[model samples]
Target: MVKRLGLFVIGFSLIVVIIQVAIPSADGRFEQADATPEKRPFLIVAGLDSLTNGALTHKTKSRYLDTLIPQMHKTYGDGGPGYVPFDSIYFKQDHHQLKMSRRLKEINDLEPGQYPSQYSFDLKGLYTNKGRSDWLRFDLKKDWTYGRVFYLQQPDGGSFKIGYRHQKFIQVDTGGSLSLKTIELPKHVQDRQVVIRHISGKVTLFGGIFLKNGGVAVSRIGQGGDLLRWHAQLNNAFMKQWLQQLKPDLLIFNGGTNDRYRSSVGEFRRHLRHYLKPFEASKCQILINAPNAVKYKQKRLLNFIHSMKAYAKQHNDAFISNQKVLGNTFQEAQQAGYMGDWVHPNHRGTKKIGNQLFFYIREHVLPSYKKEHAGF
Candidate 1:
């Protein structure tokens, strides 16, 4: 009996060791794991205005993302660009290769009663292509085994074809009620150009294309002149579905620039909470990033920042203030060559902002995450 008990204990210890070796750590380390990189850590930065689009100062690459993304890849393996917006109104796609047969009509206006709104009816970050032969091609900068295409299914929605390399195109029908849909490619795709071709109907694309393989991925979801309340107008179910699909390990909300004058403190808080409710049950960490200092509405912007800080504290989440790095006042930032105008940051200014965020993650976020997920 004593010998049997000892053997049982030894077997249990071996099982535990095997489990640990099979699982990947939150910091993206794995031992004796499969070659497939499906469970890589993902970060999403969702913001408004300049955070969504670029600053007034023209540039070849994004202001902060160009600096931040490369740094992150160096530290935690390369995971392809997280989200690529289809709209090119104010955003330039320079990180990857993209070719469109023809420019798609960008849509921002929403019909009356389509959504709950008090001031704006624009859909913000959605684009549609109606031409039957129109096609968009995306060539990834890095190798990725997984990809997903996000779009909206509306009453007048049409069909489209998605294919990669020499494989057959998959036809997707979007003739249904208004809702969000995704075409996820789980198969391995390496160094191949992905194409989306319009077949017959009008297809509205949202949240762009998501590509990742392993390691760390940082995605952005921003719309010029976006407000916290505007996000509240989206269907709760739709938002929840989208969040589940993205499955971000860290979600950052960057706002207040556009919301300062438009919404009162209480109103902003309410809208923010409503917008975040879908993520309440998610295991992903939350970060609230306050907008940088602006020349106008200093008092109102400060109020919004304070509210966001308090909310972050109450939720036990991380908070980063752009003012801490950019400057306390608009004049100070302007003098430092950070301001492209009264509100937007110049190229140099954006680089500073990106570096600061990367430092914060290295100093504060990663350490805590490593501690919490130490064993696996």
Candidate 2:
């Protein structure tokens, strides 16, 4: 009798287990209860993009990095750029990829600031413009819990009027040049579009845009008229301090166009060594991005590119060739309607560059990282 009773209980328990596995949740959905959280690798890209100073702008329409950011995410998933959306005014009319002014979520790497570094290359900057009103905009992607904004002023400081859409939020004077501002947003106005218009004075750069809840905080430290050698001019202490604060897992130096023509092979290598010294001590993996192909100096350009590749091999670091991937020459890229000007890329051109970068990272960088770290 005891054996029979035990058998009945075991059968009942089996039936219960089967039912539980087959049944759906309260809302009629199957869910993975033991799913692990995703881990994202931080990636920072520094250099010039198509829209820098409107190099290829036609009828005010130009190519912007914003167009490329989303493509990076789509191609590589989380392991790609790992971008998150935020609300901000996009000069969509000024860009080729964007056909109309629309309000939609777009990925933006929260910019970061390094003081006394002498380079305000952050993605957000206030250029001198005479128009309706000069403004910097931000739209929160998620329900905002907390946020921070950092900016570097020019020798001529200015005041900023902050607001959301059509409402006036607050106004603050930047006080002076080469300064930083850390402002906290109120929860009542969370998840709304924030606009900062230059009321008076000159604010050259808007450095940091950090959200309490966001994806990989990759800062866009790109600047127009900038070269790798220019970075070496920064105060050593400031450079070290700033890089330490960023704690970048990956650092990509996408520079050369502004200064490549002036340097010979040996000189270029020397410039790289001196420029890279500040970043060498950092634990971050450094990747060197080749300059875009120029119309002038074809043979010399190829030699320079070869030298860059050789340097990457010597250091056991990654080197991506924008010139080879984009085009062998400006004429070739122009034939494909990718070149808007002699050097910078058009909207289609920028897309191509972004795609190539996506594939290159997938083919070279991610596999090794995954093998060592399990996943990212």
Number of the top lDDT candidate = 1
- Who wins the TM-score comparison? 1
List the pairs of residues colliding in candidate 2: 87-138, 87-139, 158-201
Per-residue lDDT of model 1, residues 1-376, tens digit only: 0101000000000000001112234564533323234555555544444454543336312246667778988987677666655544433534566566654544444431143111111243344445566777767655666556666666877877776756556667776776666665535556777777764656665534354555567765544455566566655566566566566667667776776767898998887787667666566677777777888888988898898899899888789887888899989888887877776776777788788878877787777766755431
Backbone clashes counted, model 2: 3
Off by over 4 Å in 2: 1-41, 49-67, 75-206, 211-218, 261-267, 368-376
Number of clashing pairs per prediction, in order: 1, 3
User: In order, what lDDT does every prediction score?
Assistant: 0.59, 0.45
Candidate 1, residue 313: Cα displacement in angstroms equals 2.0
lDDT of 2 by residue, 1-376 (tens): 0100000000000000000011124575643221112443445444432333233345222233444455544554433221221212223222311211122112122222233234332223333322223555654333333333444444555555554566535555554534334333343255466666644544433333333222333434433344445444444443454455344556656654554555676776676665565567777677676666667666665776787788788888888776675677878777877766666666776666666665665677657766766544
What local lDDT score does residue 253 receive in model 2, on the 0 to 100 scale? Answer: 64
